[model samples]
Target: MTEALATLSRAYRMRVYPTRDQARLLAQLVGASRHVWNWSLAKRTSAYRERGERLNWVSLSREFTEYRRDPERPWLATLPREPFNQVLRDQERAFANFFAKRAAYPRFERRGGRASMRFTFDQRRQQVRDTGGRWATVDLPSLGSLKLRRTEALNGRLRSITLSRDSAGRWHGAITADGISRPAIHVPELDAVGLDAGLRDLLVIADGHGTRRVPAPKALASKQARLRRYQRQQSRQIAAQMRAQGLDPTKPCPKGVRLGSSNRRRKTQQQIGRLHAQVADLRRDALHQASAAVVREAQVIGIEDLAVKAMSRGMGRKAFRRSVADAALGELRRQLTYKAGWRGRTLVAVNRFYPSSKTCGACGAIHAALKLKERRWACPACGTEHDRDENAARNLRTEALRLIAASSPATPRSGESDARGEAAAAVGRTGPAGLSTSANREPTVAGSGAKADRRQRQSRPRKTRTDRVAVGSG
Candidate 1:
């Protein structure tokens, strides 16, 4: 097993910029590919409707070739078979995934706008230039002698290359390879860290070392503003174009507008899309770095599996949604899992129900109530003050460590696990009414009967002063 594991490899992708002619060829390839995809999809849909099951790519390609020979479909002959084959393969995968419940029904690819193509290499001869300098002799099919700017070092056997165009009118090639090794693990002491993800701060890390705040990049906000401005400009231009064309400018335009008439609007839309893509790329890069840092430094990393969907159902839903989208907490978790696995580090997840925020870190006592508005609080039991975010981070770290200890062969000698078990049992003794208390009561007297009494009094109706006065007068 160890030998097989040692033989196992890794894969990485690097973006490469191509020359102008290469970009044009890429665009043409993408258009032809999309055209092939649409035509094949239409034929397959028709066939499936008439004769159960869709036709295979080979058969379809043969038929397409015959159709191309016909004078009526000369445009089909002009289409590149390589891209057509690629599209057919993509459609096949899409259909297979849809049937497997892995993805939704395949959507038709848009033609000509942002062209792309894929290249696959055998296990051997996968090596390509990566000198960070322009290549003079690299060969690309149908587009020869293309200059490429290498962004990152390539490792292992090259498997595939996918070339795509950005909305910024830039061309990029993604080189996929195999046989890469996992990054070296930086094993630290069994110190665990908890992260609280938020809008104001990207991540709040808490550990035995102390609390630290990692703020989101200012560039994210700036790029978002730029994207919005571009989008607004594009919208106005599109509206004006619609008005000039004797169409209802307010109504949504159809999928492909008259090319020449809406050229400028289309260009603006592309610019806006490019800006969005840039922002997304920036966020993804940041997330990778942050996740890698945590995975490298911590022996065990614990984070909340926050139900972002449920949390978004609030008064300020847009803001919450934006926060969730910006943080990409789920993506962070994903990266941590895979990266940790590679490094043989532990990635622990605290239960969503865990009251990390409400729980006092200094004491084991859980706060009965903690609102989002409260940024800081003092633990009544321990008399320990805490920044709310920091408190949550501490709680997460402790809980994660506890979880890891319980799951591992090495149990703590202090019987903390036994105490925790007893505490959990005690929680169960309080019943359903008790659950509400923890979710709603104040931090000071969380589990006390006084809280229950106060809640009851609060729920009950009070007699009016006028009624009391009338009774006294009578």
Candidate 2:
């Protein structure tokens, strides 16, 4: 028998350049889509308010045909019908998310915010035309061909392509396709690593032997001065606009006043947008390099289930908050998740409150008195010295491997060999399905009797490839 390859959905974002005519048409499509989304939202809201009836996409889409044919809004018929219909579908999805309690209510989309349109047609036709060297074109219906910079070869079935304009005034296309790839299978006894995400160091990776620290980049530090200068110019320009209107500069822009945009103000905003894009690019570069390195080195990856949002609210220092934002821990974890799966590696997430820093890996004793300020501490029980970050990584690695060993059906039974027992003990665990306390114990989990303890272990959930145990304490 042969193993079958798995197919997964993937999206590739490519830089797109449109000609003068195409740009105008693309802009019109974006505006039309925005208007459709807003109008549909209003219609749905009014229907539910007046008649107490829910307006689904099917009825709304049907009414849209008549609305487009109406003389009052004939401009809606100028663009391709696909985007207007897609906007309604997108809203329907948003409503579904809201109903499922995954998102808030759908709101009207504003102009000049997120200009994008999707083309979801048949994939049997080659919508993507390769121009040979470093150039290609995306063939969207009615919009014509938009030039594309082909950085990599397009693969699989092209399902849909979304064209979007960024804040930097650049056009791009997000191509979603379905592709087949070989699944990753893990080998037994490979290296397992624990990762600690921190602002000081980008990542602290620990395996059985030692720890390695990857330094976090100071994101766009060099461009900060330029960014600040442009920001000041914008502020001064805004106040000058208010003063020109014979209104108090300190007060807000009045209800009907138009603080018209100047060439300088527009240019300043563009520069600011470019600077932000550069900073994001730099951050992604560092994250990708570090994550790729880790995925290549270790087979079993472990990390703490950090609550980044909660940490920020309680954080006192301004510098700490800024650093947390720049660290991009969430982005790094997302990359690790997909990349690890693609490479057939195992990922284990430790419970956030699992005292990785306070627990002594030497004797499995958690140092309850350990403080946040103490970068290094001596374990009171084992009398061993420990570096805070290093100890945390080591402890994380221990717990991760312990989970792997315990849940694994292949782990040697108690009667197998003395060598297997010693091996399990070396990693601070016992035989397969045995309680993880110093290796030689019979089952000291929380149960009083032997059968009760066995039942507890049996009922305990076994973790999958990316699953993390919710248990925090020893």
Candidate 3:
């Protein structure tokens, strides 16, 4: 049997530079859409509570259409209604997710946060056009052509584009497209490597050649002092201003007394936002480069399915948790997942409990009592010394290769020995039979696409990213 040609919906985030008037209009557009969402939500709540009526997106949109068309509300009539339609569609999905227990109930869109609007591609308006080179132009539903910049030219059919305003007052657009060409496959299938993620070392990669380590980039730590100073200065400025207004600095302000804003305060806040964004950009840039390097070289990449949240909770020190978060371990894996899929490489996720650290790479010896502090140790069965991270990486590569072989169309897995299925659902929890560190039942064979049953939702064969990294640096 032949495998189907795979396709992906890739999204790109580009910087958008809008004129003064366009910026004001963009703000109005997002504000109007927000108003509609809040109003529709209120209407739905009232209908359900008072008249026992349920209102979906269609019904809410119909009412909004009539409401906006009234001569009394010229403010709503001037703006294009297409973006609001997307808002309604999003609201509908939100409600559906809530009912299905996938998300919380839809909330009202408020002011003074990240303002955004979604516009579907319509050829004339709401289209993305590449002028030439790295520069492009985007036309939202109502906003005229806005200057845009990206590393690569827009290719294939433009699906829909979403524009947003961040706290720093910068404009950005996320353009979704279809049929875009992915990176070419150049490596052999046997070129597999294992990646171990940690705070001490960003990544310890093991391959046929040897083991290599990448140092961790503690981006936040580098700027921690600056961030703390800014925060303290902001706090002190606020308290001083409040005290000047004859209000208690320590206690909450009275409802009637409003603390006014100043250019100084606003400037301080924006500076903080810029710093935070810089740190994030630095971290993300590093992750992208690392993942790209890994994906470009290897055909099969094995990685641990790290439970970062659980791992963070186990750490007693705030600094430890902060370090774990700044490392962006999960983000690295996410990048690897999509990049590998795009580049025609295979990314295999080893179960977290796989004892990669405890198991010996040279000999299959399990050191149950291995401590976390022991960075280097010798195998009990064979006296070969090993670096903990390097050993773990080698083990992961072996497990990933085994799983891939077992899941192959030629393997014909059956009965109780499906290594791929076990890698997906079991194997890590327990050791060998009697010597098992943890005991558990055998997992069922995991198929490509699972459908929803009575209790749980369907499982997907693979989880791939819909967004691709920028072709060049931000």
| Model 2: CA > 4 A from native | 1-5, 182-474
Clashing pairs in 3: none
* TM-score against truth, every candidate: 0.40, 0.44, 0.42
lDDT for model 2, on a 0 to 1 scale?
Answer: 0.68
lDDT of 2 by residue, 186-226 (tens): 64455789887665577888976789888767664455445
Looking at model 2, residue 94 earns an lDDT score of 91
**Candidates, ranked, TM-score:** 2, 3, 1
TM-score of 3: 0.42
Candidate 3 residue lDDT tens string, 255-291: 7887888888888888777766665566567778888
lDDT (C-alpha) at residue 371 in model 1: 66
Candidate of highest TM-score: 2
Superposed on all Cα atoms, model 3 deviates from the true structure by an RMSD in Å of: 25.6
